[model samples]
Target: MPHGDPPVLGLVAGQGQFPALVAAGAKAQGWGVAAVGFAENTTSGLAAETDWFQWLKLGQLGKLVAFFRTHGVRQVVFAGAINKPRALDIRPDFRAARLLWNLRSKSDNTLLTAVAGELRREGMEVVSALRFVPELQTPAGQLTKRGLSRREQQDLEYGWPIAKAIGRMDIGQCVVVREQMVVAVEGLEGTNAMLKRAGDLGGRGGMAIKIFKPGQEEAIDQPSVGLSTVETMLEAGLTSLVVEAHTSLFFDRDASVALANRHGLCLYGRSDGQDGGD
Candidate 1:
């Protein structure tokens, strides 16, 4: 309606700090934010942080598009995590049911890709959340003051490809490695549960490796580690963590690094074509 209004960015908010982070970044850039927060999955704090906010159930795809269109948002970013198990309880609207019925598999990637495609068809572009917050991207090399020991380095080398392979199969992005043996692979229960299992089986000094899934859309479901991750690792007696640099997201970097350093845990970011740190 206004001749010189700032562009509005729509945010499909899920769980965690990611939606809030994206909204803050967009606002800092002098852009308006319209956030559609998921019921139960999204934090209530996001409503006050955004220019406009609406709460929608998980599979209300039709309402999601209508909210963006009504807010004059032509571009949107999908941010944060939707608890996968809880999503099963969703009462999808007709639009979402159609999309679900046509899917060959109910994998995360397939569902998200279909949603992105639907948004595109509805005159909206689904952009990367990182477009607003590039700092969340993992930096290459050792992040903690403590470098990886030889045994840990070996475990990383052993686990990196294994994690990637598992990701490729859409199984999970995280795996626990100890003494060159695979301890636990993340599944529906997620990284925290897997780490707890690894601690029980392998005890302390295991390495947690997380990587992006091959052939998956980076904008939607990139692997991420944050303060909670470090806390879980500490509780699980895991001593080291490795993530794909540039591809994975590292949220709350300062706090996470400080916690890892305090526990003498090694936090390393392995870039493509780079050797594991010693």
Candidate 2:
């Protein structure tokens, strides 16, 4: 570390506001943020927020690495979500192909751990963005003005373990439950689609439970909820949300809470061994 030379961070940007928020947090801490953004999947506004920016296709692992190294980034954070279906269209280069080949399973955890390992081998450490933006981590307790009703609490209690089990299997982060019956489990279609499907199948008053996958590398790919999530839940007639406390990101927390409060939706962050409610 030298005077006037801040720590440089490489951001692997994906969709939504998460990457931008990370960039802001890094800058606020006097760090230089260089980003490699995915084409089409990443937010366009992120380019202006970073010290350096490069756009690349999903499978351009070599390019992503070179870009960060060239910009003097020794640490990186993977932020935001990549639409999994679109990822199938990626044309992996030699590096990515070899990495993929070495994997025993292509589940999210295995793949990301491999990528992180690759980055580590390249002298770049993969760190959690929460290190720079601790505020984004969801705190334990009710997040909205209104508390969960008895039925909503029941639904959360019923769905929590199921969601964790699905996460442990690397299946998904969310499950929609109503009246203690599973309405939908989030798959490659993502949380929003799962909520929509739940609305169609079970109608209103369903609870969506999202949790960090067991044994996941927490530095990347943590479950996240944002304003868009609240909007989607409202549209899908969902009445409550349960996210794993401290292991999930809650972007735009105030705005999300306001919107959920307005819509009379309950948002709770529950940790292991704790009951969810007001």
TM-score of 2: 0.95
The residue pairs found clashing in candidate 1 are none
For residues 169-260, write the lDDT of model 2, one tens digit per residue: 99999999999999999999988888899999999889999999999998989999888889999998999988889989998899999999
Q: Candidate 2: lDDT over CA atoms?
A: 0.90
TM-score of each model, in listed order: 0.96, 0.95
User: In candidate 1, where is summed lDDT lowest over 10 consecutive residues?
Assistant: 269-278
What's model 1's overall lDDT?
0.90
- Give residue 248's lDDT in candidate 2 (0 to 100): 93
- lDDT of candidates 1 onward, in order: 0.90, 0.90
Collision count for each candidate, in order:
0, 0
Angstrom error of the Cα, residue 222, model 1: value is 1.6
- CA shift of 237, model 1, Å: 0.8
